[model samples]
Target chain A: MGAPEPLPARFAPGARVQVRRADPPGHVRTPWYCRGHAGVIERICGSFANPEELAYNRDGLPAQPLYRVRFSCRELWQDYAGNAGDAVEIEIFQHWLEPA
Target chain B: MRSHHDMGGRPAGKCEPSEHEYELWEKRVDALMMLLSDKERQLLKVDELRRNIESLGADAYDRMGYYERWMHSICQTLIQRGVISIDELGRKMAELEARDGRA
Candidate 1:
């Protein structure tokens, strides 16, 4: 961790956001399940070195904000077997999200 | 490419959470990998390691056990980063096998 470089959060807590469904070839952290799904931003997980770049040994300079996005299980999986009330959460890099 | 590692929703089978004994080597493998991932070490990042594992061919990924997958990924990363060489590793393995009397 380095000195906190204040970066503006793109989405606010409780804001609706959608995960980009772009399946660009290469290493990515956004799981396939969450792709194209709309969810609520649970919280801003603060700025950190971008993992996508970090994987390539590149300094994740100008860290990006990560968000804990929450989605209903029923919404995420059409054939979801768990309770409809159940939800799936994933931490997504800000770059992958867009206002819904 | 969508690797087998991301098959979360695919219909595989029932969610039978089977409990099993952890082999000593498996435990050690986990610890060793984590140690290598320490900030001071920076030998590999978790995501980088994951991408390495995911990039494996489907046959290899499906055939490997959990810790076996970790072992393979760690070894591949070390080799790719030039931190170690396959020749050196193979030589060490041969020496160990010889010491163990495994012709």
Candidate 2:
């Protein structure tokens, strides 16, 4: 089968976004911690086949745009006692992000 | 449902990281993973490996070492792809065990 048409990159760098909180079965690269958290787009990391579909041995065509999202440590953990300025970055697929 | 493999940010004891040289079998498993996932072969995708590893219940995940999990996933992937059958694998393993017993 041929590669699926690529999805367009919607959010630009520095755009405010939130990770989707929905949980579905099968393989998901989006970690549970980041779900429902708000973050800013750090940078664009190009597009790749969706790992969710790839796990099933399917041709994960229509590659999705990937972005490095930056979230403050406090935003991730409610009881975080570390430096308030501390932040964590994660590479997230476009499908998992929505405008904040 | 939260999978056992998703252990990010969970409260846990302090991590005492250590390193050790890979054993022969571990090396073989790593090499096998690379060769199978290589572009030309493409018999296995890293996603498949992760899926299988995640499917392994929490108990097995905790008990098995890193490469042991990878080895299990590799065999499962090959079987899922019909590249080899369970009966064939069982027979081969039994044959090797018999030979070792004789030795």
Candidate 3:
């Protein structure tokens, strides 16, 4: 079984948050593209077991809240040639986000 | 180690259209991987499976197709977890190949 109970979600939908810039050497779920990128929480995906610990065969204690953060492509890619209206989205853990 | 599977934005390649059908072994591999993750089996979590697939070296990672990656990862995972011994797996594989040879 996972954490006795799912951790209460910290961020809510439409909340502005920034992805923490980090280069963890171990197994990480945060995608490098979205690192240090500011985005809005599109939605709070259901909490899931912490993959970081699970990768090492450790018991992923309390589950972590996951959020679907959406970002504009132009901001994510310095020279993104796609349409100006294009955007990118990725699921990030609560631990990786800080108030912008 | 930071694996190549994290292709997030570091890329400059055009996406290729799939023009071929799934070979029989590929389809079977897909189904078998799903079964391993079943609640009853619990041999591997989907995330662990992903990590295993990403852990492959650059050569095997690029040389193999999508399902081939899954097959490779699944085999390694089962073996690492000690759920299925190598000898048992080899015997089953040989049986399967012999059946195919006769067909």
Candidate 4:
């Protein structure tokens, strides 16, 4: 069989997106706290890792690009300090994000 | 030292009408106590779990991605057991978000 299809690269820096939580027994980069939450793409970190590669014993899963997403502290927390302008940056796999 | 007329203000009915009624009340109290104890135990367990998870450090945390997957499985299990409705699951998810300051 031909090599496995490369995972799709979806977003770029400055793009708005939402993270999705993929449930069940599989590797995923998205965290539960940020799942379904809207955030802005901060930086597109180059691809070198894929959770599926490690979770399942399949190194064939092509390397997928990762991204650094920034979400406002208030967006993620109820009691976040309003004046600090805090944000959370997480390295999420491309598949976790979609256009927002 | 009181006359029978002085008992007028007291409840005149039987303390327990039937053995069945007594048993039902006993069961109700037992259920309530069990629920309270369970709530306390779960709270402590959750706190400990959170601490253990957080103590893993940043690199180790990234390496271990099963916690969320496990939590999702827990939610599904609760739903299947009828302990929580779908709406309650959503609410619990929202609570998690709020805890992380995402909500």
Candidate 5:
């Protein structure tokens, strides 16, 4: 059988992106609250850990750098104050994001 | 007359337990209790979330984007709370696949 295909790495710092929330039974770091929500990448944290690898007993899998994403509270939460520019920073595993 | 069977319970076995032994026993029991309680709490949370999802009904579920957003939050919470380590969560997913007989 052919070797397993390497997982795709997408998105980079300063890129706008949205998280896709597939159902359970898959490894993903993007929180549900932020899925389908738009945000700008604040930093391209190095890839060192893959949540899928760690979740599947593959601790030895190459470390994938986690990105620190910044999402505006208003974008994520309805009824968020229009005047307040609140934001939340979350570390998302590489697979969680895709270009908006 | 001597009774054929001792009416009084035999004196409690007098094996003096050491302080270390007492501590070890206490720790073991506490760990077991915590593990059990943690599992129960995790199951309850999962159940609650599932019910909430179900109650939303199919159309609403998609409209609200329930699976994509809410599920991820629950998984993150589980990781944050230490109820399940990242590895354990992976194992669970693997098990589900195996059950479905998916290669």
Candidate 6:
């Protein structure tokens, strides 16, 4: 069967959120550059099975909400030598985010 | 800790983009991926393939090309899932090597 329906969203569009900095062993999709950084939710990209669990051949039930979070370039890079308005958008899962 | 594959924003040299025609084996690997991950089969997942690639260690990761890594991961994942046995793979490789006469 196809993936289950997306889980209900927790944070709405434009909500502030931060990526959790935890680094557990095993497969993960969250990039290291975006962790522990604050950003605004650009949009919800629907939910899907957790990649970490899927990597281990397990059924990732209760799919987590996914979001395209927009972060300032300066926030992600200390010396971003670019425009102040420059930003990067990354797809993050609900389990990796916390209200900021 | 950051995995070796997660190199975003890290210090790096200029990125020189280039493209070339994919070799036959590369295309075959792509087809294998599509077939293995097809809905009816469900023998492998894209996530599992990526996890295996990431776990290939820094040395092999840098040494192998993109499709090379994918092929390696496909074999590794199939073995991990008990879809293929190591002895079967070894025998096949040996047979091919003997037929090819170490070329």
Give the candidate number with the greatest lDDT. 2
Over A38-76, each residue of candidate 3 has an lDDT whose tens digit, in order, gives 999999999888888877566676888999999999989
Q: Return the lDDT, model 6, position B2.
A: 76
Candidate 4 Cα lDDT to native: 0.59
Model 2 chain B: lowest-lDDT 10 consecutive positions: B10-19
Candidate order by TM-score, decreasing, is: 2, 6, 1, 3, 4, 5
Instruction: Tell me the lDDT of model 3 at B84.
Output: 86
Once fitted onto the true fold, the runs of candidate 5 whose alpha carbons sit more than 4 angstroms away are A1-9, B1-103
lDDT of 4 by residue, B12-92 (tens): 566775443345545554444345227453321222223334444456555644444234334443454466799976898
The superposed Cα distance between candidate 3 and the true structure at residue B77, in angstroms, equals 1.0
lDDT of 5 by residue, A7-87 (tens): 445677788987765545444445566667788888877656455444443442456556788888887777777656788
DockQ of each: 0.64, 0.90, 0.52, 0.01, 0.01, 0.83
User: On residues B3-92, what C-alpha lDDT tens digit does candidate 5 reach at each position?
Assistant: 212112233466786444345545654444344337454332333333333444345554654234345444554565566799988998
Q: Give the per-residue Cα lDDT of candidate 3 at B88.
A: 100
Query: How many pairs of residues collide in each model?
Result: 0, 1, 0, 5, 11, 0
Backbone clashes in model 2, listed as residue pairs: A4-A62
List, residue by residue over A1-100, the lDDT tens digit for candidate 4.
8656666668878999988754533334356667778899999887754654533223525777789999887887767767667888988888778898
- Displacement of the residue B77 alpha carbon in candidate 5, Å: 19
TM-score, prediction 6: 0.95
Question: lDDT per residue, candidate 1, A10-54, as tens digits?
Answer: 889999999998888667889898899999999998888887787
> Against the hidden reference, what TM-scores do the models get?
0.89, 0.97, 0.86, 0.44, 0.43, 0.95
List the global CA lDDT of all models: 0.87, 0.95, 0.85, 0.59, 0.57, 0.93
Per-residue CA lDDT of model 1 for B6-94, tens digit only, reads: 88777787879899899999999999888988988988788778878888889999998989988898888889888999999999999
Candidate 5, TM-score of its B chain? 0.36
